[model samples]
Each structure stands twice: as C-alpha cells, then as structure tokens.
Target: MASIVDEDNKKLYIFDEFFRKGMLNNELAQMIKDKGYSKEVIIADSAERKSIDEIKKLGVPRIKPAKKGHGSIMTGIQKVNQYEIIVHPNCTNIQDELDNYSYKKDKVTGEYLNSPIDSYNHGLDALRMSIQSVKRKARILTVKL
Candidate 1:
C-alpha cells in the first residue's frame, strides 16, 4: 500500500495486492472496495489487457494504464519524493523492491546506465504507475483550465 498527499496536502492511500495463485477480477475489485479505496484511482499494467477489460466489467472506476518506460518510472519516483510517502509495514514487497532496485551499470566504463534492473520490481512498478497516473491527471486538469 502507498499513500500520497495532494497539492492541498490531502492524503489518500491506494492498495493493490497480487495473488500468485491468481484472483478473479470481481474478487480483486471487491477486495479493493472493502479496503475503502473504491473511489480512488487504480493504475494497472497495460500488459494485462484482458485483466483490465475484466476489471472494467466489474464496474470499478478510474482504472488507468501505466505509462511504460524508464522515464515514466523515474518521474514517479520523483513525485514520490515530492510528496510525503507512507508505506504500510505489511508492504514488505514494496520495501524490498525499493531496497534492491538499482540502475544498470556500464561494463567497461562502470558508469550507471539509464535502464533499471528488472528483478524485484513488481511492487515498484505498481507504485510508479499510481504516481504517474496522478501526475497525468493533474496535467490534464491544468490543460483544461
């Protein structure tokens, strides 16, 4: 789980759980709603096209696709730093991902590469998507007015 404070400093917490055994869209949507995040936005992986469609069928609101690429991930990380981030203690996967996440290194020059290591990144990816989704929404709102 992750929490973010908006421009008004209002805090909102969003949760996502991945079941290795796989969960039905209805089941997952109910679980999320039970957690009191039914009104909050959900950022899902675009790779899960079928799952996204199924979740939509379940009537869950504000489901958005996460922007892919290192730049989007980096932007999310920056946004996290900009806001106060509160992680639930039970969110060990997120903590472990943040702890072990690193940038690739050049073999000959020993310089850090732009790409990030793919391992231990599931939680990180979810968090990144959430942040990016908020940022995108904010941008759209700004453009509208």
Candidate 2:
C-alpha cells in the first residue's frame, strides 16, 4: 500500500494497495514494476527477510522492513489511530481490512480486549508499517480516520 502524509491536516491517505495471494518473489517484483511502484518505498513484514531480500534482488527498489517488537501492534494501532485515514476509492482491500480488523474480545464477557483479533489484518499489517514509516519521519501527530 502507498500512503501520503498530509502533514498540514495530520491525516493519512491510503492511496494505493496491492493484495495478491500465493505469489513468488519474481512475480511480486514484476507486479510492483508493472504497477509503477518499483521505485516507491515498500514497507514489508520484518519477519519476511528472505522474501524481502529476494524481492530486492529481483529489482524493486527501496523495500524496507517494518519495525517489529513487543507491543508493536498495540503501539502501531495507537499511532495510526491518531491520524485521520482517508482511503482512495480503489483501495477496497484496505477498506475491507480496516473495517473487519477489530480489537480482540473476551469470549465470555464479550468485552473488548487491548489486543486486536488475530484474523482479518493482512492489509492492516501493511498499513501499520506505513504508519510506522510516517512516525519514523515524524511527519505528523495523531490519527482519527
């Protein structure tokens, strides 16, 4: 996914998202190039070093690993929540992920937990990386959308 930092408004615009299942590194690289995102900075899962290296070797430029640590998810959720996120009309995958990715709940009490549910977060995971990128640059403060 590609996002823009509207620093003036402290808002995040999810401009683009690419979601594909079961793709090889070369295929992913080709898709990035075909989409004209070969030069754009791609923030990916830190756990996928092999895949990321393979993609880099295959020629997509500026692919970076996202920050990962204890509480990173909760922290990311908080950070991203500070900005008003606006999704482009075509980024349906992102929209769906955001819509379904909710906080975990107590099964018996039905109370919202601090952690998010494990399901429905493929796009949101990427979104968190983008949020981390923005925070690393200190581009803005707070989220609401």
Candidate 3:
C-alpha cells in the first residue's frame, strides 16, 4: 500500500479490504485530510484492462497486472461451498472443440471461417481453476428465487 502512495513528507497507510488482516491505514486516509491531498482509491480486477483510459482519469496511481480469482478463486469453495450459474459464450465440451470453435465454416462456400478459437474459452478455464482449487464438498447452495 505504501508503494502506491503518490506524494512525500506526508504519511499514508493502506489496507486490503478482505484478504489483508489488520487495521485500515487511516493515516493515509487521514493525511489526505491533514494536508488536503486529493484521495483516490481504485478497486481493480482481471477484466478492468479494457477500460484503461477511463480508469486513468480518476487521478490515482493504478495497480497493475491486476489479479484474478483472488479470494473467490483460491478459496471460494472453502469460503462458500458449491456453485451455480456458470455462463459462457462459444463454449464447447472438449478443449479441442474450443480449439476449433465448433468447426464453424462459411455456409455459402463451405470454406473455413478461421476465427481464432483458443481465446474464446480462456475465461471458462479461469473460472474452473478458481472453483476446483477451493475443493469443497458441501452440496448446499444459496440462491435467490
């Protein structure tokens, strides 16, 4: 958290919302008050890169190489066992099916469509890694009806 601090001579404290156990660094939050420094906080994740230009306008130093599947992926099953509502577009049963994009072809000429396939299913792999890593066996699932 100190690494992200912008200015000098003024002290700042930072804290992670959930994973980091301890008190919030009110000094930094306070310093913004003490010196009247503008405070900017960023909440970022794996999918935020697409909005790079928009995020930069907020005036806070950016945290980069944003992490995915933090608490949820690494400990989601242990934290909240079971899963529901998996959604994926262009998904296929086998990895190779994903590799081939369901073998889409130009209907008119039967020529290869040649759309890049591997990129389509990567998000699902990311989700699978997170859920399976938790290794929870409880069948109870909480849902909104």
lDDT of 1 by residue, 37-64 (tens): 6566666776776776676677756655
Measured on C-alpha atoms, candidate 3 has an lDDT of 0.30
**Model 2 stretches astray by more than 4 angstroms:** 136-145
Off by over 4 Å in 3: 1-43, 69-72, 75-145
* TM-score against truth, every candidate: 0.69, 0.86, 0.22
The TM-score of predicted model 2 comes to 0.86
* Best candidate, TM-score: 2
Using lDDT, give the best candidate's number. 2
- Which scores greater on TM-score, model 1 or model 3? 1
Clashes of each: 0, 8, 1
Question: Across residues 1-145, which tens digit of lDDT does each residue of candidate 3 receive?
Answer: 1112212322111211112223233432333334333343323334545443333443323322233454544343232123333223322232333243333578899886544234433333333332332222311111000
Compared with the true structure, all predictions reach lDDT values of: 0.59, 0.74, 0.30
Worst 10 residues of 1 by lDDT: 136-145
| Ranked by TM-score, top first | 2, 1, 3
